[model samples]
Target: MRETLAKWRPAIDEAIADLIPREIDVDYLESFFGEATYEYDPDGLQRALSDPIWELLDRGGKRWRAVLFLVFIDAFGEDPAAYLPYACIPEILHNGTIIVDDVEDEAAMRRGEPALHHLYGEDVALNAGNAMYFLPLKILTRDPANLPADRRLAAYEMLMDELNRTHLGQGMDICWHNERDVRVTPEQYLEMCACKTGCLGRIVARLAAIITDQPAEVEEAVARYAELTAVAFQIGDDILDVENSLGRAGEFGKEFGNDIREGKKTLLVIHAIEKSDPERARRLQEILQADTNTDEEVLEALSIIEDTGGLACARERALDLAAEARAEIDGLDFDPGTVDKLHEFTEFVIDRDA
Candidate 1:
């Protein structure tokens, strides 16, 4: 899986660069946005947009979502390289989300460095992040792939629906984290993950199916696989946060117990709260509800999760979901190599330490 990702990184990075250049200039602006209604300020734009956007991009990310799109294209019997511009959509939007998420979460670090909002003021970061949500829409408007009108329309509608769903998921998460009294059931957590995490992966799968003109049944099947994989990946992420805080895993980027600091209602916290003794459960709730916590408090929270088997339970659930994700495509007509890659993709999402 790592080898496949490494092999594709250069192409994915190049596609990203083509969409958002190293430097913003008049020519790029004219090409992307039609002739300016008034004079444009290249310098101001560069400072506010290009510099900070690339600052986050240059800090590495797995770019797995983009790869997932391409792999789905291949699975659907199409030339993945032909859709490179479209592939950039999910990757760029993902970075945008994380930048905004950092600000909202009051995150101290991202990708092992200060959050974008910290380096650039909140206004600049917010605008830049918001711009990313629209920047990639240029691909759709330009019709660079010369896609059929219906296919293009499908893509547009998919983006709108999925992006809106993402906000809904984010809203649920924020409301839970900010309030201590909201008890998030495991089922509710999975639903939130499906909306927040699964939506992007659905974009990848559905976009591929749309471009390739796959049958409706096939599209649904492939999308289900992608969504399940994404949810499992999110669970793995929650586990890694706890593991890194416990010194059970190496750096996964972000701070240790940052989730605890944010008072995130992660699956681990949910399980631990439900399974612990009443006194311990109340203590856990009090710790999470507090405005601030010491390192010792964070460690205490992690210990409670570990001792109550929250970590183990979450891990088991993640693995089960991964297995179910693999099963989603078991009867598909993909070639042998694509099947292996798909299986590996499912495994990578859940098993990855980072």
Candidate 2:
């Protein structure tokens, strides 16, 4: 796996290196928020608000989404310059949402520092999220010196639709917080992840390809690639929540075993619930509902999940979907070099620890 990633590193690095804007338009991002931020005496609302946006930018994640966008666009024969704004639109929006989500989840830290909301207050945290939310639109409109009016309008329309869907997804996530009907089938949960997590990322990747003037058929194919890989990414996240022990740590803003506590319909939980003996299930339900499901109790549940086929099924499903994505990439009209880098990214998604 390391060798494969190493081999593809150059193209992937080139693709990522190309995404950093030569000169960005920061003013336009804040323009939609209106210049007048409410007067604040203490707590440093302005500085706190500014911190998350820059932290989000410099955090330097995998940069996979941007890389995917650039490759898909290039495959479709579009210049990187034309598609970059669209790529940044969703990335910024995603980061913005994460800022708010950490607050909602009460996450203590982001990128090894106290969460924005934890340091600042919820009010400032929310504003920071809103500001990051419009970054792409600002980037698009602020610098028309380079683009024609029609193309700029097209970019805004596409970005708006994606942002709207992302909001719906986030709403669903919050609603799931106290949901009792944890009986959603694997397929149903996949649908949730699709809309909430995978939907925008996949759609915009292809949207970037289309903006580059690639045929509609090619764009659709690339979107499929994004869709398949997204499930793997989501599953990886589920695994991390269980493995990343909040108890041993000094702080974790989000609740440890939050998925179990919130009755999140994860594959492990769902399958464990389904397969446990009836008496065990009844006890499990009681334990789940009670306020006293201790760490030891959650560990028992984890053991049950592992003993049953739930964990195996999830791992198999994630890999199967990733394989499907790999096949789609092969069928696309992209260069072998680009396709190889994409495979590395796919592996990265399934294998991510955090």
Winning candidate number (lDDT): 1
Q: What global local distance difference test value does model 2 have? A: 0.64
Residues 15-78, candidate 1: write the lDDT tens digits: 8888888888988888888789998888899999999999999899988888888888888877
**Tens digit per residue, CA lDDT, model 2, 1-354:** 345434444554342223322222344223434454753322343365545466555655555565567666666666654555555655666677788888887777787677878766788788878776764556566543366676567566666665676667667766755565555567766777776777667755755754565566776677778877887788867766665643333453445666666556676667777888876665555556665567666656656666667766777877887898899889876777778878876786545653
TM agreement with the true structure for every prediction:
0.94, 0.78
- Name the weakest run of 10 consecutive residues (lDDT summed) in model 2: 15-24
**Best-matching candidate per TM-score:** 1
After the best TM-score superposition of candidate 1, give how far the Cα of residue 148 lies from its true spot, in angstroms: 0.5
